[model samples]
Target: MAKVSVDRPVAPSAHPPPSRIGLVGFTTMFVIGTDTFLVAPLLPDLTRSFGVSTEVSGWMVSGYALGYALLALVAGPLSDRRDRRRVLLSGLLAFSAATALCGCATGFWSMVAFRFLAGAAAAFVSPQIWASIPALVPPGRIVRTMGLATAGLSTAQCAGIPLGGWLATVSWRLSFWTVGAVALVVWLVLLRMFPSVPAAPGAAGGLRATPRLYAAILGRRRLALFLLGYFVFQAGNLGSFSFVGTWLTRDFGLSTGSLSAAMVALGAGNVGGSLLTGRVAGRFGPRRALLLGLAVSVALFCALPFAPNLATALVLLSLIVGGVGFMFPVVMTLLQQEAGDARGTVASLANAVMYGGTTVGAALCGLLITGLDGFYGVAGFTVVTLLTSTAVFAASGLFRADPATA
Candidate 1:
């Protein structure tokens, strides 16, 4: 029996610098990230356009998450056996086309179908970026590079939603078209600037071998616990977030402009957390940083429902999102490290878990919101999930010693 080698060829030092690659990756992710959350603010417009209730209209959001989750399991492993650059470029091209079709959708079902396709395309794109980061940089800079990539995501959350909301005021279709156009431009830039990232030499078995790889990785108790913890955490975080537009409009009667402004504040908190995540993880260690973020999130989730006005709600919600911003980079870095040579498969599965949680949470929120005290019910659900995640994290034993200082 031959021992499988775990090593892959690193990026050439003389080619595209890591900083340039990081910037391109960040831009690509920013477009993808913006598309993910852009729909939140457009829920009202969609409801009006489709002549459906907000609860039913919410399925469009869930559709994207569901598609992304299912396809990611396949995409990750497939990328591990092919050229990552080709996979990424192909995904980006499909994403742009799907997004444009979404903008042209004439009804609810059509919109949902296009959104799902868009997400499926994106499933192939994002994991490549995550897998490439580890290959593109030295071990010491991986977390920092991850931080930059995550920051792109956070910045999109902060700025893209507001931009989308502003565009939706003119026409909901405009937002989708805008996103599609940006994606096309980014695809071109990436095609020109991105370096080739070959698949791991020993990971050529593709989909047939993915299940065994996942089984082996999940056999590690600590890694399994970490993934489970992330699932629970995202369920709580996204459950409440998915309904913010409805809550704001129905409860406070805020217009699109006002809602966009409020979301900008929330996004700013995320940006701050993303930018600081590397330093935070380095200083306190990933375990402590994750725990602290969860604690902050739980406290904020509990307090958000009590806010007397929109101003108070925005502040509390921003802080809660900030906790999410802080947690993502740390957890992602840990997951990537655990994957060894199977980075693409691991990263994709991790993303799948995250979005799978979103799908469940968003669908559940849709059901809950149909009842009285819907927003409060959602908030309660968030707190419970956060607490559960905290418990799982504590019990995982991954934090027995700080990874940074060890």
Candidate 2:
């Protein structure tokens, strides 16, 4: 029932290697993620440059995120109607332009406008990769290829955060300029190497049709359940993750340098796991592998509070992030499969929920971190949420391939 890609897609070859599409996917995710992390390190400089209170400066972060999250709903249905290749290129061009414009901003609101545009443009780019992958790759390779894309974000957390800080030392504008330049290079490569992918056979995409399309998609009973499960999955994962730095500083008395080093170690584990977890998919299938990873995360969280030393805590954190890496591709693949031809719609929804989960998680954990005696509140809350999400997935009955048989 799925439409074959023909007009233009990420790759055009009859039997293109997964790595080729994955390469562009990785680069796209990395560029967007780096931009996301870049603003945090540059915040102080941004405040001084814009002559705003620290609180007002936080709008730069929220403004970018608002564009990214809100526009995804619109971009999704639009990508579903056209050649994703063109859509991706246009998004890249717009994203690149807006990123560069951030360097030229004369005042606070102009900078926010540029960042919002950059984020909105970015919303269009990633959905194309996620949507086109199934049509572009061998069936067996879907989850594996998604893992390669997932690696991009972990890599950004590891490398780009510090790079942004270092660039900020010279000038915050340099950070945007650097990422924008890299994005331009990526756009060129994708333009040359990518091929055409057409819309789903029967989809009628128009601004007017957007509401009907979403109404139909959301009307599906199983998919709605699946999306709910994914939301909770992210809520627990991100909630626990958001607190790691605070936990380290409080429990270990680690300074900024030591905390960064510890975070890098955990991030490295995430990157490694993201790159390698495809093998787990090959062996156990995506659903089983993901459940296995979640179980491991639950165990890790359970043990983390009891860790007696910095080394022990770091080891546990690394494994936990690695488990997250192991889980990501599988969950994404399942969500895409549930999407059927609505890959773009589902991908955008996924991103939206991911941000929502992080926001809600961080907010809730703020209270838990302060309320319940050391890190136990965070640990206990995370464990309960993980288990609850796992239960949701189990009850949804979506994993029909069954880990039992695999």
Candidate 3:
């Protein structure tokens, strides 16, 4: 708590206690996650301020995704080569600066540029939380701690979106300023809580060894297939999710306020499910938890297309997202186990594919809806991808029990 002795780098053997580090990791992830959709409600103000069309104004959102997607691939390797605390602190510093800069933007491109910079910096920030959990916590606590960290993201979305929207009602710039200020405070907390984590085994050979380290993971067919499976999984998963808002509006005739309330409810379910996952996975093991969550997700998604009323639709949507919440941390924990020492590389790749999946799923679902009509298209596509992911994970032996980890 007393700054982790900054004059000298603290090694993992002398790392901060698991309980303390876990809280900081959770807080670290929450602060970063809170900023994720903080810009959503500001879009209208942004459009007016920039004198741009709706589509052009969307570049603000697109800019963040673009920056994150592009930088994560690079951030992973860079993270593996140094003390993760250094990477996290450095990244958070940049994130805080860029976020605050958004409130001071002079014009459209400058705002977009600042958003992009914040996002790029975030790519470096969030993944470190994921990558560091294994090194910081005992093996038995890894899955739960990961779940705790994961809950931070879903919970942040539940909390942050509404907070940002409210702040936007006051002033769009106020949202950025508030998030920036929160991030700075979180930075100070992390500076004290996080120790300088030892680099991965791959880091031993220094900069020249980075390529070989990458090749080691790439050369393995199973890991490659697992990544491919994850990519497709994200595509269907995000694709269906992205259209839920449109589906509710078109069919249920919900107003913007109604829709926001519904989304918050769904996010609440997701937060509950994520927290539940840790206990369930801890008791029954991740394999059973994963299977059960996957089955539930498939059923809920299949049933979603048939909801006859707003109540039914909301229940089905909530269930679907809840199931998704349960599955994510288990999948992530399994992936981390597989990665062992190279957690950053895998986290980065997984993160990148996740964004890629969101992109593809959104586009593909749009076409599906055009052809098939309504939520049916999105739900049907999601079901297929979910099933495919199950098969791929099975084939990759991702569900196997690890002797070293619970």
Candidate 4:
């Protein structure tokens, strides 16, 4: 049996101490999630504040996604060739500023502009986290650490939105301010705790391979269908949360408290799902776990529209969010293994696809809800997208461990 080598060159530590790195990653994810979902509970208030329709108010959510999607393509390569810590810190600082700016903006359009900038800035951190993880931990421990990191995000999603909603009730502007404050803390922690790791010397040359890389990523027969399917799958999971708070307000006359509670449920589900995936993926194989997640998510999301009451809605939402949590961690694990030594570059590219899906899901849902008459249309669209994504993932045979690893 070929044993794994203990003498392999150690990957440079971009994150400082294990505990500090985990703390920074956790805080970063917490604030980012808060910023991203903060607008959900406040969408109605935004609509009222700016005197815009639900569609226009949605810019608060969708606009950020647009920024994230556009910048993702470049963020990865830039992280590979530069100091990832600096890149992450700069992004967090910018996001912090943008979130604070969101508070001071008097009008809706101004808020949208700031949200977009914040989104673009926030995009930098996620890919950096992904790139840094393999470097920070031993290979055998990578999956578990990633799980913990994912849990941080899940906790943020579960707790942040409701807290944001409650804050918004005090002052919608306060929600943004809160996000900024959290981001500032995260930036400080990262600066103080995370070590500086320089980019690979010839990493710039990797940028020259951009076209080939793009083609390789997009055109690979084994990966193409999976990527496409995953894109749609993410769209479904994301799109529901993008507008669900608004639906609750419009459909069931829910209060801020009730809406916040529902958001909490969603976040809890995310955490639960991620934890479950971490335990199960290795046992079942990443592909099987992913397929299972997508299948369950589709069913849960489809059932959301017909939920009879707030209780039912929250229960269904838990299932949907948990499914998302379970699915993505597995996908990320698969992606890392697939990328091999060029993990940073590969991570960046994968991030680009993920954010692209986010942009599409948010925008597409916004368009559908705004263009159509009701929330049902939006829900139906989410179902279709998820189903399509599931089918796509199922058709592709990428779930098996790469033969190279074998």
The global C-alpha lDDT for each of the candidates, from Candidate 1 onward, is 0.83, 0.75, 0.75, 0.73
Report the lDDT tens digits of candidate 4 across residue range 1-406.
Answer: 1111111223545333565556666777778877877887888888888898775566777778778877777676567667777888888889999889999989988988998898889878877777776677666666666777777788888888788888877888888888898888878878887766666544444456555555655565656676677678667667657788878887789887778877887888888888788577767667777767766766776677778887888888888878878877788877776565556556666665665676677767777777765466777887898778777766776655435442
For residues 326-378, write the lDDT of model 1, one tens digit per residue.
Answer: 88888887776666667787888898988888888888787777675637878
Candidate order by decreasing TM-score: 1, 4, 3, 2
Best by TM-score: 1
Structural similarity to truth (TM-score) of each candidate: 0.95, 0.81, 0.83, 0.90
TM-score of model 1 vs. true structure: 0.95
**Colliding pairs, model 2:** 8-195, 8-196, 8-197, 9-195, 9-196, 9-197
Order by lDDT, highest first: 1, 2, 3, 4
Cα lDDT over the full model 4? 0.73
Question: Which segments of candidate 4 are over 4 A away from where they belong?
Answer: 1-17, 205-209, 370-375, 399-406
Cα deviation of 159, candidate 1, in Å: 1.3
So what's the TM-score on candidate 4? 0.90
Q: In order, how many clashes per candidate?
A: 0, 6, 0, 3
Candidate 2 has a TM-score of 0.81
Candidate 2: lDDT over CA atoms?
A: 0.75
